[model samples]
Target: MDLTTLTYIVVGFTFALYIGIAIWARAGTTGEYYVAGKGVNPVANGMATAADWMSAASFISMAGLIAFMGYDASVYLLGWTGGYVLLAMLLAPYLRKFGKFTVPEFIGDRFYSKTARVIAVVCLIVASLTYVIGQMKGIGVAFSRFLETDYTTGLFIGMAIVFFYAVLGGMKGITYTQIAQYVVLIFAYTVPAIFISLQLTGNPLPQLGLGSTLEAGGGGYLLQTLDRILVDLGFTQYTTMEEGNGFNMMMLTMSLMIGTAGLPHVIVRFFTVPRVRDARKSAGWALVFIAILYTTAPAVGAMSYFNLINTVKPGEVGAEASNLLYEERPDWFKNWEQTGLLAWEDKNGDGRIQYYNDGNEQFAQTATEQYGWQGNELTVDRDIMVMANPEIANLPNWVIALVVAGGLAAALSTAAGLLMAISSAVSHDLIKGIFNPGISEKGELLSARLAMAGAVLFAGYLGLNPPGFAAQVVALAFGLAASSLFPVLMLGIFNKRMNSAGAMTGMLVGLTSTLVYIFTYKGWLFIPGTNMLPNTAEYWFLGIQPESFGALGALLNVTAAYLVSKVTAPPPEHIQHLVEDVRVPRSAKEAPAH
Candidate 1:
């Protein structure tokens, strides 16, 4: 079969499997809908957590970021991975022991203030909504390319799939479906990596292949070869960090780590297990599953980058005959061009694509004067690198089709998780907890499904006009989570004297500061061109990008909370005792009711 038919078959089968799982595991009650009835096995929950945690940002965009940004993107890998460790070690078991259905519920009850709970719900909704937009964008990109639909149409199809499984199954259905998704995504991710690794380095393991010598051409170490290739094209060396970027990188990494811990969707995963001990066990298993892809990402990024450069510049950099002829471009190039993610312009009427760094004035001058190149003639969206990698390598039609399925699975799995967090915050935390304490369980469950449907529509609309590529948008979401939620959650759990006044104040301060900074650069509410200042280093406060400002915002949150709580009355004695109780290990049966 041709590639298009095969993609339809593979993607169709995965979708059918997801909906079937959702039907089988459809939730029957509030508990099942919110926390999978608290009966999930540790290993199974771990796999499900992996699927939920590794969104399109991880599967579709991280490698792409690594390919383009080189050493600067290492922060994503470090921050996200380290942040999970922070969650597993510092937060998960304690939160699981508190035995709440949602993060906002824990906050409200812990702080003994409904206002605190409402603020947390707002934070969760904002962060989850922002995060889900990235997933929607990834879905759109995959569908637009493989299904031959427009971006908006593809996004709607993805939204419908999410609505079906997420609304019907809730956490119960999503958990089981995510397990299958994890398998599909991991297989799809690794198979291509392994194939490309062997092809490039004569090694089957992508991890080892990254450090191995190139099996063809000049036969240098892979990193060295890649570095030389990039530098020759006026790009920064692939393995070296640019000077003056250290601070931004450090802040970005810290933001991502704390943001990971604060994300309500991932935190809720811990609540699915039956016991606190199981939460810890599941966290360990999740780390293992997550590491599988994280470790392979660098190799995939580097190899794909190498392949891309080789294809575009066939022989030598800056050589008149080296540039690939526009009409002779590979099928993958034409395919992506139709999606508008890849484009070429014949500057200087050379009839060849010149893709060097036009921003490097020194190199641009030389290219124009010596090589008769006018400017950079190609625009390649970084988000397309991973999805297009298999095709670029001329992999089998089935492999390319499998990649489409994997990208959709990664995007949809996290989209479901985030929508769950948003819906639960609205229905369980806002409606049942605050507005209508006497609401019936059935009513709340129905409200949760309706909330999810609404969230899907809102997120899909934002996906139609994303502010950035998949991973950059996700980084902004992480910043929101880190600034708004992580500090308050940590204080609520670790500080016995932490009061409602302090918790509420901290959340508002962190969230407001971070959002304002982000809006000033990323546009108010992420509407493009609404930003008051240019999103460049020269315009940044202390050279901190909006995405890296979360750590600073989090610090402000902690400091503000501390000062505010010092003058206020401490928590009630019982609340302090409750905090003490949560710190100690106990069975789920022994945990006190919220």
Candidate 2:
């Protein structure tokens, strides 16, 4: 079958699988809807959590960002994965033992105030909404490419699929669907890497293949060869550290680690495990599953970068024979052109494609004076790196179809998880918890579904107009979570005297600071014409980009929370006991019934 037809089949099959799982796992009770009745096995829960955590950002955008940023992109790999350890050691088991259905439940009860829970619900909504925007973009991109539709139409289709499963099944449905999604997404991700790895190196494992010698039998390491190729094209060395960006990377990593730990969708995964031990074990399992992709991402990025350069410059860099004739480009190049993601202009009117660093003035001068090249004539969008990988490698059509399914899986799984988090916070935390304590179970469930539907619509609308690259948009979510939610959760559990007033003040401070910083640079809530400052590095506060400002905001949260708590009354004795109870673990048989 042709690539388009195969893609339709594979994608249709995956959607059927998700809808089937949703029907089988549909929740009948509020307990089932919210926490899967707390009966999930540790390993199964782990796979679902892996799917939830490794969203479109990880699957579609991370490697592409790495392809361009090189070593600087390690912040994402290390930062995102490192948080599981923090979750396992510090948060997940305790939250599981607390036996709460939502994050705001834990915060409200622990702080002994409805106001605190309301604040938490707000933070959860903001963080989750920001996160879902990226997922929506990924969904649109995946659908747009594979289904050959416009972004808006693709987004509507993706949103409908998520609404069917997410609204029908809730957490119970999302859990099992995510498990299937993890399998499909992980398989789809690895197969392309394996094929590309085997083509470039004798080694099959991408991790090892990155360091292996090129298949051309040169003694030079693959990374070394890649470095030489990039440098020859006037780009930075592929394997070397970039100057003046180390601090930004470190701070960004810190933000992602803490932000991940604080995210409500991920934290709520623990709530579905039957026991505290299961929660811990599930986190470990999640790490193992996630590491499969994380370890391979750097290799994928490096290899993809190398492959792109190698394709454009087939002979020697800066030589006329190396350049691809614009009129004679490959089918893959022409394919991406339809997406408007890949473009070429004969700037020098030379009738050839010159892919080089137009940003480097010195290189442009040399190219113009010596090589008869005007400037960089090819513009390849970074977001298309992984999506275009199979095509770039000239892999079979089925593999290409599988990649579309994989991208959709990643985006949909995470979007469902986030919508669940948002809907739960609204229905379970705000509506049921504060506004109407006596709501019927059926009413609450209906409310949850409606909230989810609304969230899907809002996110789909934003997907039509994204703020930046999908991964960069996700970074904003992480920054907000780190600055606001993570600190309060950590303090609420670890500090016995933390009161509602202090926690609320801290969250407000953190949330406001991060939002203000991002708005000043990115625009007020990412409106196109409202930015107050240039987003350049030179305009950054202390050389930190808006994306990296979360670390500073988190520090301000800690300090403000501490100072506020000093002047506030300590938690009442019952709240103190509640904290201690959650802190200690119990065996399955001995654990107090929720």
lDDT of 2 at 48: 98
Model 2 per-residue lDDT tens digits across residues 153-191: 889999999999999999999999999999999999999
Question: Candidate 2: which stretches are off by over 4 Å?
Answer: 217-219, 586-590
lDDT per residue (tens digit) for residues 150-207 in model 1: 9999999999999999999999999999999999999999999999999999999999
Model 2 is weakest, by summed lDDT over 10 consecutive residues, at 585-594
lDDT of 2: 0.90
Model 2 residue 145 CA deviation (Å) reads 1.4
lDDT for model 1, please.
Answer: 0.94
Assess each prediction's global lDDT (C-alpha) against the native.
0.94, 0.90
Predicted structure with the largest lDDT when compared to the true one: 1
